[model samples]
Target: MDDTQTMHAMGIDDAYHVEQVLARGPRGVTELVTIDGVGPFVRKKIPTVLAQRGVWSALGGSTCPRLPRVEATYELPDCVAVVLDYIPGLTLEQAVAERGRLQQNEAVSLAQQICEAVQELHRLGILHRDLTPANIIVADDGAHIIDLGIARPFTNTANRNRDTTALGTYGFASPEQYGFAPTDVRSDIFSLGRILGFMLTGIYPDDASYATLLADDPNITPRLRAVVERASAFEPSARYQSVQQFAQALTAPSDPVDPVVPAPVSMLGASNGGIRTRAIIIAAIAGIVIVALVAAMTLIPRWVANGDAEGTAANGTSQNAGPQPNTSPDDNDDDMVPSPDSSTQDSEDDDATRGDAAYDNPLELVETGWSADESGLVHYAFGLRNTSDSVCIQFPSVEITGRSEDGSVLFSHTQALMVAFPGETTYFGSQAGNSNGTVPATVDFTILEPEDYNYVNSGESASFKVDNLNAAPDGYGGEIFSGDIFVTKDSERVREQSSQLNVSLVLRDDAGAIIYGYTTFVDWPPEGGSRPFSMDVFDPPAYDSFEVYAQPW
Candidate 1:
């Protein structure tokens, strides 16, 4: 559709003109439009039927300040177009890409804004099925959530019906969006957690990348990890029940008070205005808290308990202390636990030349390489192999020292430590500008000891079996493994409607050495039934065999 022609046809007020194209995508086109005597606005052509144009117009500016206000709606022949307040700013995605990662307090503060906006929408019975970073704009005023392409009203239960088509971004989408279940506020919470993780780590929250966060980052606090882990749990029941509750927890994890519920006022029978003011004051202070204490009670205990045991085993002299204050507020920290694959490695992958404890250190320097970017900035990358019996290994830091031709110090660069998986090599590097004309002749690189690591260990449970497993070559020289995990319901019937199920896949080389693998939490396979799963192992070695393990979380 011609934007200028469309606005001319509308004949809005005394004057109206198309300003510029804001964005164009699968949904439709968004343009900046200006109407004389009415100021500037944004117009979006929504192609999807479930778009919340009218709802947005009704709610308008009456709701949360972070939400865009709809000025008008037009039903075009080919699309439904809506005019909204033009929020000029960068998106959260753009901000992260430009700034690398957000500060801890900034992330939390922005998250609270997002939570408030989402909470208001939920209160009005609206569900924004797609709440990705691209849909959020970081304006000068605050973080504004935009795009309602797939938004559905609470009364429209058909929109909640299960479908095979995925409705959100791969890394941020909740499992239910992939037809596992219905989408709800919890799904948004899941995306919020993923966003929080990205803001903290500067990494997308994909299964593999997320494992790195759980495996290595010491800057991430235990409390924050607990919140993110539960929010992004495979099952909706495992996430924060509401955005408000999640916000409350983010605002104050130590507080026991519930932020969503309003305390009863002794002057409830007083004037309406007075009661409204009282409620506002309460809401302002109550802050936020979401979900039941059950998830925290269940997940945290196991994380702490298992992490304690694994820390002792991974670092013999490591202290297994209670959760401590985070050193880097922007980074996330969690206690590492021993995974199930750890045991399998010990029993099957032992080498004749090396004793069982040979892989205890698990830190092996792989290779270091450097390249220059378009701006002549030299980027240095170093790879490390984790030969640990455990599935995951952590590194505290990496330092590169350069010396001049005379053997004098030239420059030094230190990169933060990272997490790597068994059979998989992880890389960390830094970029430096060589404008000083002092290129070093000799350079020494060192891998420092990791602060802590949790061996992700799980035992073979009699309750579940991995069947119909198949491995094939991916087009990109990688291997793709697919299989089904089934639970054999017996005396240990999961009477509850919800349960935490964790699954892992391990591949071994010809010498029985671990090479590639993946671990993920999934919704409980149907009672006495199975759920399909798949994983792509990039640049894997020729495998002699593989192993799959499942356990109820």
Candidate 2:
């Protein structure tokens, strides 16, 4: 393996017949090199002492299955070159970005695997000081931990609380790595939690775009969200003590346990103990009530059968004429009749309650604008607001009809937005198609409800105002429009629900004739914050003017 093969087949210092350059760093270079017997392998050159120690420990000692295998290492004049097994797969970061947010179950399973690997490393007295998403690779076999460049021995001694260097990625790194505390197992646990957040939100922990953590992300479940929040707590003492513990809690059953109900006395055994005593007491009380009722029944009829002191019967008739008795309470019905005023008031209250329960058209089109690029494509963007306090409506589909100057239909396009939310103003942008004329004369917008759309019951209401709206044309015949949605929080508590925003934009001619119509959208906006939005249209050169509208159904 040490024999000189070629000088320059692929480039830099052709000593090892390099197939391709994988990566290059300030201190070292990674390349795909071939051997006579071994088909292909990834070779990394470590020009620094710290990295060399990591490669040496991995090659000679670490037994963690998740860690990459170091096949061989050779000392260079000023560096050490290590040959490693090249696992074929995208990095975990790449996987998350490509797949968007992973399902909760999938993220949990993946986190468990990572925990197992890191736990093994800690058991072997190694601390992977830099454990970021880029250091993990997802392949057919399983997730593999890579890039142990900063790994070092972790001693449990009291004096191990201090370190000379502050090393690790922001957001993923623990406070200890910020020179605030000691770097230890707990530090890795913090990074793992951040990684879990990334997998569940498709957003890195430190990115400004993910300012709220998982607050607005609908893909994450509340149970998982709580787990992440606790694990990523700023204080190390507040986090899970170890990787194993964190994994256990992550995979633990989240649903609350149901309380046990007491068995009925009838189902108890005939032991003649407490059960027998309770039964006898209940029977005695029932017997006394029965005797009293019987005594009253025996006396009531006799009293009624006899005439009163005035010689009047119980039926309010003269006893001398006839001993008439009332047979039922309905004999005097006038006192039971309802008053007109009270009845009318009750009816009005019912009508008001029904009206409150009814669903209103909560979708509102705030505004619309257009832009065009040099390529002749026209872009349209619009704003929409959800007016209903409780209902979180989503637009499953939409239809737009473009008409000519004479009001005759020219073209139409149907699009699925899959957008939803309540109270926040959502911005939607889309490109219009090439037009036969400058623009369609008039346009119509239609919104379709999603299959699983349901209105939720909420006590609070949300309101938003669109401002700072502007539009411009791009060089590619596309338009760019931007605006800020200022949301004011409701005075009452708001119920959290998920929904998407769907929108339609129409270009109209001066004659009020149909011109062009299209659909577009942006997903749910934050609950109560100012969100700036921009839209681009690609299909170009249509109507003289445009109108924008939004709807959630």
Error of 2 at 70 (Å): 1.3
Kindly list the per-residue Cα lDDT of model 2 for residues 1-553, writing each as its tens digit: 1324222222233445679986553335678887764547778776544364643564457666677777776665446667777788899988987889888888898898888889888877778877777889998877888777657777553633334344565457665553223577888888898999998888877455564758755776677787787677665666777887789878777623232232332211222111133432232222111111111111111111222332222211110101122222223312122223222322322211111122334454454343322222234444444554444443323344555568875544543332335456565445442322234444444443322112333233444455676666632234555566555543222212112232344554344332233443333356566555554433223344554544321
419, model 2: CA deviation in Å?
Answer: 50
Which 10-residue window in model 1 sums to the lowest lDDT? Answer: 287-296
Position 53, candidate 1: lDDT: 56
Tens digits of lDDT, candidate 1, 1-553: 4888676645542245777876654345678878764557888876544356546654664657888887877665456678888788998989988997677788888888888888888887777766777789999987999877666666543633332233565467665653334677887888888888888777776434566764445667777776677677665665678887788878675633332332342211222211133432232221111011111111111111111222221111111112222222222222332333333343322221112221234455665433222222233445555554434442234555556568976545444332344444454333332323344454555654442222222221235678999988644334567789887643232212124343455544344433333344455676667888765443333346766755432
TM-score of 1: 0.45
Give the lowest summed-lDDT range of ten residues in model 2.
Answer: 292-301
Name the TM-score of candidate 2. Answer: 0.43
